[model samples]
Target: MREDIEFRTEDGVTLRGWHYAPDGATGPTPLVVMAHGFSAVKEHLLDDFAGFFCDGGLGVLVYDNRNLGASDGTPRGEIDPWQQVRDYRTAITWAQTQPWADPERIGIWGSSYSGAHVLVVAALDRRVKAVVSQVPLVSGLANARRLIRSDLFAATRQLFDADRAARYAGAAPQMMQVAWEKDPAEPAALPTQDTHDFFFGPIQDRAPNWRNEVTLRSVEMFVEYEPGAYIADIAPTPLLMVVACQDHLTVADLSLEYFEKARQPKELVALPCGHFEAYVGEAFAESAPRQLAWFRKYL
Candidate 1:
């Protein structure tokens, strides 16, 4: 069964979430809090994950981050990693209040950009008993250095500065395409065919609420954010880091570096596929079960 729910953040912003109870559930069950990645909504393949978890006898709470999807906030399309991390904390607090939720067994799950957010959230929020991060963005600076050419870095910085000025001058937030069809003349935040097809192809069709554009300031915040720094802190709490071996977006090597620094009670599973491919097909088939097992053992 599924129910639409709303919760208010400490800042008074009303965030929305979907609560899913396991089929034939008799009483309170462990809840897994989930959210989508960069500029994504709950409908963007998140239901598949939630369904799998719920089917595995775990309750699921999938929500949109502030300023995106069904959530109410200003300056839409803004992607602030820190703010999103805070939203995860708020989601946990809200989940604990649910009548069918086992607060002590609450776990967090995230993919892509949000995968990184869960690491930070688990580190600071001891209440989160377990965490599963798939294809996570560990270091924003490292990823920025890899994705943004050195020649274009300066130009990108200028755009960020310009957007800040424009926003302060009573202008609307500057918007940019999150991903675009491969074109040398038209650069996008994620200007690759894989990113383009994944976001604009069938996924976009399935998720009617997804916006293909994000604020310029979102890119700026993404470049400066670093979630890997908190990985080691997620020690006493169990963590599962799933990596796509052929991932160019988040890159497996950087993720491994942070994973090595992490303490015990952690597990790493490397999938034999690219970042986006891990979302479906044989890769996802291999990953989902492992996640369920980990959550079962820990949460």
Candidate 2:
């Protein structure tokens, strides 16, 4: 069974999500809280993963982050890492109130940027009994340096600074394409076709709420946001970090380094494909079962 649901953050921002309960569930079941990465919406193929969890007898709550999709907040395309993390906490609190959700057995799942989020959430929120982070961003500064050319890095920094100044001066926040074609004349947060197609192609027909743009301030926050520092704290709470071996976007080595720093009771799984491929087809087939088993054991 599935139902549409809404919850408010501590700031009173309304966030929307879908709640999926496994059929024939006799009582309250473990709930897995999920959200998308970057500017993605709940409809961005997240239902696919939610279905997998539901099949494994787990209730699922997949929501849109504040300020995006059906959620309510100012600055439509704003992406704040801390704010989003707080929203996850809010989601967990709301889920615990549900009659069919087991508060003590809740788990969190995310991929890409949000994959990093679950790491921090699991560390800080003891209520989170398990976590599944797939191709997560370990260090924001390292990723920013890797994606942004050294020559253009200064210019990008200037844009972020300028946007901040403009917003303070009563001007609208500057906007930029989150992903775009490779062109020296056009600047995008993710300029490669792989990144662009990864977000736009597969789920285009399904995810009408997904946007290609975000506030320039998001780039500023992206560089300074580091979730890997909290990895070690997630020990005792089982963690599963899935890596895409050929992923150029998140870089497999970066996640591996963080995994090495993490404490025991953690497992690392590597897929033979790139980042986006893991979301669908043969790759997802291999990865989703592992996630299901992990949640079953821990949550």
Candidate 3:
């Protein structure tokens, strides 16, 4: 039901992933193009999500974002939101041309960081027929402000400045853990308890390729991103946003605020759990089915 595939982006970087088809299917099928979030690989609960669609008689294109798991890119563990957004469009273009895929029926599913990317893509690329952004990072700057301590804000800015100067002088890019297991107060990229537990937990046994590190510059770029601003532009394309009610990383109030900014043809479903919980256990059951229904209705 799944096949390994690779395609080049416009800039010639190869992104790799799986193309899933329902068993005994024939003719062109609606395809949902998907990618993982910040510093995440497809093994991070994406296979489970893809199965929900593929099992419901839809095709799915699940890929590792560039520089993470199963995909190829340089300066590993770096994440540039705009670059990933471009790649999402690139993946959609490739999926559209596939013999088994219906070009006009392309839908997109993204979670966490890539979740925000899909919002930007759907607004800019009219070819996206439908979109599902789950537990998305809406406002990077606000999120950073919420997560970082005010007293440490100056020191944090210093980190970004020092990293910039070091790179300017030919030093290797500075790196930081994607999550910190022992202390939430640490200087890791995510710096939240749920993020640490989610990334550092047993899921690692399933996805060993996932490194705990990210480029320090990735944090700077993250704070500058404001994908929520694109929400208002996503109308005319059916959109579904899944928000975790108790989410600390991407707070619920902020997500709700942006959801209102969006015009019609959009729906918001609240999962009564924290951000990371939406990926597994009961929350996954709550989140995945509704998303599949959206794809079924609009894809």
Predicted model with the maximum lDDT: 3
What TM-score goes with each of the models?
0.97, 0.97, 0.98
Candidate 1, 72-181: lDDT as tens digits: 89788888899999999998998898788998999999998999999999999999999999999999989988888899899999999988899899999999888875
Q: Kindly give the number of clashing pairs for every candidate.
A: 0, 0, 0
Instruction: Give the number of the best model, judged by TM-score.
Output: 3
- The per-residue C-alpha lDDT of model 1 at residue 221 equals 93
For 138-226, candidate 3 gives per-residue lDDT tens digits of: 99999999988899888999999999999999999999988986777666888888888888888878898999999999999999999
Better of 2 and 3 by TM-score: 3
* Whole-model lDDT values for every prediction: 0.90, 0.91, 0.91
Error of 1 at 5 (Å): 1.7
User: Which regions of candidate 2 are displaced past 4 Å?
Assistant: 181-185
The residue ranges of model 1 lying beyond 4 angstroms of the native Cα positions read: 181-184
Q: Which residue pairs show collisions in model 1?
A: none
Q: Between which residue pairs do clashes occur in model 3?
A: none
Error of 1 at 269 (Å): 0.9
The sequence of per-residue lDDT tens digits that candidate 2 reaches over residues 1-299 is 88999998899899998999999997899999999998889888889999999989999999999889988898999999999999999999999998989989999999998999999999999999999999999999998888888998998888888888898999999988888845534778767667778666756878777788888888789899999999999988999999999988888989888899999899999999988888999999999999999999998
